[model samples]
Target chain A: MKTLSSTWKEMKKYRHSYLMIAPYYLPFLVFTVFSVLMAMGLSFSYFNVLETPRLIGWQNYINLFLQDDIFSIAMKNTFLFVAITGPASFILCFFVAWVINEMRPKVRAAITLVFYAPTLAGVSAFAIWKFVFSGSEYGLVNAFLLKAGLLMEPLTYLKDIRFILPILIVVQLWMSLGHSFLAFIAGLQTVDRKLYEAAAVDGVRNRWQELWYITLPVMRPFLLFGAVMQIAQSFGVSAVSINLLGFPTTKYAGRTIVTHLMDYGIIRYEMGYASAIATILFLMQVIFNKTVQRGLKRIGE
Target chain B: MTNRLNRSVGGTLFLLFFLGFLGIFMVIPLVFTISNAFKPLNEFYLFPPKLFVRNPTLTNFTDLKQILANFWIPFTRYLFNSLWVVVLGTGGHVLFVSLAAYPMAKHDFPGKNLLFSITVLALMFSPEVTKIPNFIIMSKLGLIDTYTSMIIPSLVFPLGLFLMKQYMEDLPDSLIESAKCEGASEYAILFRIIIPLVKPALMTIVLFNFTFVWSQTSGEMGGGYIFSEKLKTLPYVLVQITQGGFGSMQVFAWDGIVAVINFLLISIPIAVFLITQSSIVETMATSGIKD
Candidate 1:
């Protein structure tokens, strides 16, 4: 309904905003958005880094589900990993954070530091885990077991399927406690004590009742935030698996959807196939994240 | 009175037990890693791994130094690369996210919802999801093996934008209005006034980016993006040394060298976290909670 001059005037009005966003947004577009688009495009074409990409349509997607049985196993393992670690860490972080929040200020800060310290050290800290589960008798687990008279010989935890998944899950839970834990602690701090006092006068007799009636309801947004972040995190468990269990663990036990993607994208240089895997992971995250977001909306009610 | 006293004792016991579990899971691992750097080679290789060191020494540091001296590239060069990229990258991440955030947060500009949704989308996908496309794009731009490739992509950290916008929205309108009345431009208002006001938010993201990038390039994982041995960061040097193996670098107990490197790698972030954690938590004091 507008004429050219009016449209131009409107554009002129927002010129400053356009300028402010351009420098950063341009790089963001190139690196994040445009690259994502390129990945989607590459998903439909076969390129081996040297040849010109040839269009291959949905075959990549088809191959992902049909021909690639290892991917199905990987997908299943990822779900199990997500199912266990996601909620367990969420409740653990919240509960632990709540308890820590009750401490004197000095003690609270110190405890938070020790708990969150695992993630701050990131992969370097992961180095210790490799030794813990190493094949050598000098490895912590092996040494402990040998000294305990549990085993006559060292067990190869990383190479053996029986031990790999459980160990990876434990290590995953440890490293991930930091983010949501910190967020929960911060969320707890923001909770006003007056609410508890007010609720107490209303016949809230004990801590359990206070938590359900007061703290949980009050911290719904943080709960939602933690749920979404931890879900996305559990879904995308790649680096730690690769580090602890090696890229492709024995009998595909430690193979995650991410490792599968790496097998194609990085190892084989099958960019299109890799892109398809990436797209699937991308879609799964969006789906799971949204479902959690919707599910958490009415928790207190 | 007896029932209440018993309950108090029970609560204290539970808390103490929980703290002990945390020490076993969290503290012992780090303490063990740090202890690796100080232990004598023979002590390191001991079958029942000694929880503490008897003959603590600095030979690990010297061993790490001796190896680095053999490399074609200088160890200082790798350290420099990591420092500058992290410093510049973290600065850019904060500056860019805040700039884009200011307009998006304050103004009723067109397409604000669309723009904000894109950031939320970006945030949802884990960093690993983006690394593939980001890597592809890096090669497409011929930025592979370049520091620009490493630093530039990380500069657009979406979490910073999300947090910055959230922090900016909490700023009182009267403050910005007063500045506007005094004839300050948006740029001046942002750089001079608004950013200073959001010091806690700024400090939090700065520390995160510093810790993250310092470790990222330091070869915590795969030494993302950079390839040339000389262009490598400090941790990459550690990776090459250990990965290249026993002839030059000892494995496990005999390799106190890797321990010292990991010690340095682990300490910086932990030390920084301990020192600056209060401010980071301080930002969250009012963030995400609404009356």
Candidate 2:
């Protein structure tokens, strides 16, 4: 009885600890771990979501890497988007954050909001921007270009394949300004003011030099994090691209991995194939994240 | 000395010119959108894009009214859905995360280090990887398209968990020990003692979740809207409008602009949330860093 009572006492001590963490941990284990295990298992089979999934055994993956033309295009577009948006957003965001950080405190906060505001704007703002960039004669972009004598006629920005991806890239940079800018701002705030002051005393007078030796080296972790996030975000560019600009753009330029997944999963009812694509996307992100983590570790050292 | 002074002046002028160029590039879209919101349809189509809304009318507002009428069914319901989901969802997140965070940050449990490491590792997984499995689970539970589907899945935010854990790690440990010596229950200790101390972290989580939840509805419009046309959120309605493809041009009306404006109106809560919480947001960004 004494032993049991002592055990109960011990258990009671840990009860609150268990309760505190369980809400997030349990759901995470189930949804993140269990569901992922199930998805991995399901990827081997032809699951229509309703019907019992039959074991197809690697055929879905086989087809994804081999037979699918749309899959190739989707993969290509996703890579292209990552290539374009990742660096463009990162450099632009880092520069803006640096500039904002250079300002006085009140002015800095206000301008940070200005730069970050577009990111908070999200799709609603994107839609408004879409109107401004519309192909019509009255569309602000076209109207301005026409007035400047750059072009005699309004260009079909969304419809034309040559311009669609770049347009998407630009829109993405603007909308995502907040997250990366905040990340950069977060990074910038951590730079040792003493280091900069010492550098200034040693004749490091320009913004460029101070940023190079003091700022960049100090903010390396944040820079790595922001870069990784941008890369991951750019990789998933299909969500906005598909929604804003339809798939099979005049040249199939904007059809991304996600678009292909939606096409198969929702439009075509090929859940098995879609699951395979999702699996590949998961693998790619994991690799990218690990690489960034390694990079961050090196920078930390 | 005069030549050096001239060079400095020239350089300053060049720098100002460049800054102005970039500023204009950044500001034009913003100015145009706000201006166009108040402009008449005639002004919208004008070449050189009228810099001012000459003869600004409430026509846009009237059009907004018509669109709101058409969209009224879905818009309000969606707003309510998002509000509850974000509120309850973010609340649950903050509560659970802080609870978990305090233990990991402060206490030396049997497996604390292992648990902390794993939690940190979990932060690396992208939401896309987890989303499908989450959707499947939601479907299995018959929670698809319901508020439960949206809110329940988000309660376990890895990033929030990580951030909270990181924030709490810096907290002084004596606070917990003092409360313990008072013979306070652990629940009392956590709820009464630890939570209030982490107001900044809590506010950051709240503000982050509020903005994220609002924007997520915009991005994942189809998932939340489900089959109920009346249940469609503001962004979902805009998506539907856009996705309907311009093929439905016959139905195009002035009301479309109003509908868009009404969509913009829904952003006010988000804006206010950001403005009020801006300081907290700034702190979260800058607090531990070199600044």
Candidate 3:
């Protein structure tokens, strides 16, 4: 009773603080928190927007796992994307940022802009990729390969199931140097210059040794942040698939969890099934992020 | 810093060469988009395709104007809608997120850790998971098809709050304590002391919010909430044109115009980033996630 009273007293004292945050927190509650809970709940029931949601126990999830072939394809493709793009982008961003850190400030800023430009271009830039991979002799890659005598026929890249996933991975890696890259560049700037001097005095013989010992240790937090960002981005790889390969690619070549959710939720109005997919994805992301966080914590230990 | 290990000449050259090679792929699409916008009809369909325009012309821009002139809604209306959402969304996001971030960073309140943890957890997952529920909530609240549906969700971007709080935590407690000793209120101190000191973070948040809002298509942000033709955003209109919604114009000329529209859509956010680029680096210096 005394502890409860003291907690109430603390809350009363911080009333002004509560008032200040209410504008943001209230909307956050409705849009993010409440919506997350609602998605979890909706995963257990069936609703098509035309009728009331009816409780069906675990049927939706059972249907998703046991019956849905497309869901399995999406799951396999999503895992493939995350496994490849996540680590590649993380290491790529860090290495690029490390290299860029060695340049003069003006050059650093300009190089940063060049690498970050594709992400800034947003989805509209996908048009340029379409033109490059237009599946015709006139397409940029096809033309170049043909001129070099490397190809006898034009390859329909986006439409070909064999080529779609790999091409998407490349395009994804191209745009992957985004916020996390900037975070890394900034993180590098924050490492105390004195540490490098100390490491050198301690007989650190090479740049690689210095990086492993000093830079990686100091950059642990940023690395974790970068990992989380990369995981979210890699797992959420839908826009590229939807834009480049159309909504449903040949043989479901590039279907991901998000695009699957879009298929059922937006087009078919299978709200329950879609919510189950989302719930599974949410669980995968949260669990994966937690694992990465735990693993990052062990770095430099 | 000067006593650090010197990079080998061969290694340095190899790294630079590697960067240059990757940089070409990084830059080609953007260059092609810009160049295609200026290419004439004959150049657009040239055999073995040209990466640059040999003969630049203003016809693509004029042709785009003509195509847009045929839309049911005036082109200016789309522009107006975009500006309205971007300005308000970015402004509201920066202000409200910072306001919330201040207390989280500096105050000793109940549930502070829990609130911060929740926000971090929110950041881990993609927002796409919540789209269905958010749509249902929006319809329940009758915010569907309104500007509020677009602007309200942006005000609480978890990353913005996370970055702002991380940046603000580096501000010395002595500053806020001194302000308090001078009889300043929390709001006054935040505006007078915190905001000025954290200008880099503020600018970074502005750039992020601006980029997000500016590039969002109606289907992405509004999530099918918007139904009115007049309420659609500029990107939505540009996307429609590229999808050949404005009707079948000459194929080659339309492709050039599509390129022009892509260039226009991308350039503004790039400009915003250019203005705020330095501060983003500065803000990110302190944006480490503490365990």
Best by DockQ: 3
TM-score of chain B of 2: 0.77
In terms of TM-score, which candidate is strongest?
3
Model 1: residue A122 alpha-carbon error in angstroms? 1.6
Q: Comparing candidate 1 with candidate 3, which one achieves the higher DockQ?
A: 3
Per-residue CA lDDT of model 2 for A1-301, tens digit only, reads 4597776676577776777788878887887777666667777889777788899999999999899877898898788776777777888888777755655667767666666666666555666666667888777789878889998989988888888877877777766664556767766766667787777778886666666767777887567556656766777776567656765455667788877776666666666777787788777866876776676555425
Q: What tens-digit string does per-residue lDDT give for candidate 1 at B79-110? A: 88877788788888888888888988898766
**Candidate 2, TM-score vs. the true structure?**
0.86
Better of 1 and 2 by lDDT: 1
Q: What is the lDDT of residue B63 in candidate 1?
A: 82
The local distance difference test score of each candidate is 0.79, 0.66, 0.86
Interface RMSD of 2: 5.7
Candidate 2 chain B, which ten residues in sequence have the lowest lDDT sum?
A: B1-10
Proportion of native contacts in model 2?
A: 0.37
Q: How well is candidate 3 docked (DockQ)?
A: 0.73
Pick the lDDT winner.
3
Task: Report the CA-based lDDT of candidate 1 relative to the real structure.
Answer: 0.79
